[model samples]
Target: MPSPCSSPRLLRHGPIFFAAFLSFFVSLGTLPAKAVEPDEVLQDQALEARARHISEGLRCLVCQNQSIEDSAAPLAKDLRLLVRERLKAGDTDQQIEDFVVARYGEFVLLKPRFEPHTLILWFATPVVFIVALLIVVLAYRRRSAAAQLPPLSKAEERRLKRLLEDR
Candidate 1:
């Protein structure tokens, strides 16, 4: 008798089982990890929505790449609570944001405002891309020019013919 691992039934169903397992993990990755706890949520729905919006635009200081809404860090939780508190205090979104910026510096904002200080951050990628594109064009032009061998002189053509005959 064959072992269970080598059974024809298992073999037939293995790929289907593997695909379902893979898809389950893939779906999990697509789901957002909301870190807001029950106590942090505001009683007012509109205020809660506004707070969530503000939180999404604020960066998590501990997880610099993730927004506060998506981050699970303690600091992110604090920021979320702060946003809700400000909302309860009847602060406009701008005021709440300004308050946070004043407290945490501009680094806490997920999207930094375009200003003289951040000009390089906004323009560097395009400037570097333009420079790289120019370099590639220049290199390609040089390679094309180099490959064209200026119509090898008559004497050089004769020398090539002689070498080929000798070979």
Candidate 2:
């Protein structure tokens, strides 16, 4: 017998919807970004390509989850404009990234800058796991050793039995 979760309508529509949703999501996931303002375009295709690449890696602080390329927020628009301006002015990609990172702190870059400060973010999980494992192992060893200890004295057992009987 089919379970309620596996009925015919659900099986048919469920998979159709799932496939449609997945395809829709995958297609849309490449940031439905707007083209640059006609005025902002550099005369060079390489510069435009470079601008797109850089913008895609910079988060729009105002839009939360969207990159500046995909965001329509005022701040995103401003940042995108700034990026184009910088690119047209002959700034290298690293220089543009560094300038934005400096202004926005290390948080603006989609890929964080690897340095002493960020080593903590990368290593925090391992450090926490190691500490917790040590604690668990110590606890297990304590319990095991306690279990292996000689049984309580006969007198102590008798006293415990008497107390339980009274209760």
Score every model by TM-score: 0.77, 0.59
lDDT of 2 by residue, 1-167 (tens): 88988898888789788999999989897757674567766678998889989998999898767788877788887888888888878899999998998898778887777799889888888999999999999999999999998888999999999999999
Write out the backbone clash pairs for model 2: none
Q: What overall lDDT, based on C-alpha atoms, would model 1 receive against the true structure?
A: 0.94
Clashes of each: 0, 0
lDDT of 1 by residue, 1-167 (tens): 89999999999999999999999999999888888989999988999999999999999999998999999999999999999988998899999999999999999999989999999989999999999999999999999999987798899999999999999
> Worst lDDT window (10 residues) for model 1?
145-154
Clashes of 1: 0
lDDT of 2: 0.85
| Over 4 Å off, model 1 | 1-24, 157-167
User: Alpha-carbon error at 73 in model 1, in Å?
Assistant: 1.1
